[model samples]
Target: MTDVRVVNEQAEQLVGAAETLFAAGVMARSGHANLSARLDGERFLLTPGFVRGLRPGQLATVSLDGRVLEGELSSVSAEIISMHSAIYRARPQVGAVIHTHSPAATAFALAHRPLPCRTEPMLRFGQAEDVPVVPWGPRGSDVSVRGISDVLERRPTTAAVLLANHGLLVFGPDSAATAHLVVAIEESAEAEIAAAAIGGAVDFPEGAVEAVRASIARVSA
Candidate 1:
């Protein structure tokens, strides 16, 4: 079991992230979302149910293999254990995963189209390619998990994906980065759709993403 202090810290981060999403106006109307953060190699801390009004005590500690190690796992939260686990297994560097029915991003998922990188934030956040959409499957089913796993395996550089007819899923090194990604992608989607009224959103040139990366590297260096 991970230490109680560590679990609480991670849970706090999840709570803050959920609030941030809500504040950004990207969270689903139902306020239902699942968030998790890696506690170590074997375990993670997860929100047990709805993300709105989430608190540290409402979290559960689950092993990477999907065992609920501490706290409580609601049936709803339990159902998605495998879904979150699939990402951790496929990408060892990812420390947190968040799933939400954010409107604009979910619009792309509903349309079965990838969210193209049409804004600088999309490129700044490591989204060099269009965010892929995983075909719809029963939520938390092996088929659904497999589709997510397949996309993660195939798109190693993408930080997020659209779950067809469902919602958006974002993962990163921590809850903060993942939350920021959800906002960035959702805002970009909203902007692109609005642009369609006059003229369609224009995509970055072929080397734009690479150029941004190089510039960031140089500044950091």
Candidate 2:
């Protein structure tokens, strides 16, 4: 059986994190994002739908088969839960997923251009490449989930991906790591835009990129 206590604790934590982001303006008031945490092999927890400014105790525990066991007052974010579920099913290493529509990142998404790795944070995250925009899938459609999964399958090391004309989805080993990636992606997007305004930015040298990757690997190990 799955550990109910652990699932509850993780769900609460994710809710708190979501609230913190919303309060800080990382998530918009119109319910622009959602967060989820894996709960063993068969279950996960996700934020509820239309619930602006999530808080602890507001998250719902959901089975891999999409059954909701808690927090019935709110519905799951349609595309959000599916997207997170897809990733968790495909990548057992992923413990948490965060989806947000932070302004700068969303702007890039709308433009259908990948944010260039013109800064240190971008390179440090995953050897900054053009954030590929997955083709538009109808909102709330399974197509978005499939598109995201396809991209992630091809680029397994990626911590973040931009959904074409949508927003950003970031994943990591756990909630804290996923949250860090969210911040990194937003900062990278801001930096890239700022650099573009100041003239074109330069890509990090191969040596620098290698050094950063090595350092990350050592620290992670």
RMSD of each: 1.4, 2.6
Tell me the TM-score of each prediction against the true structure.
Answer: 0.94, 0.86
**How well does model 2 score by local distance difference test?**
0.74
- Model 1 lDDT at residue 32: 81
Our tally of clashes for model 2 stands at 0
Q: Candidate 2 on 1-115: residue-level lDDT in tens?
A: 6677787678777866665566555654476677888888887878765447566576777777667767653433644566778888888988888888888888888998877
Q: How many pairs collide in each candidate, listed in order?
A: 0, 0
lDDT tens digits, residues 45-149, model 1?
888668778888888888878799878987878999999998888889999999999898999999999998889887777576789999999999999999998
Specify the highest-TM-score model's number: 1
C-alpha displacement of 221 in model 1, angstroms? 4.3
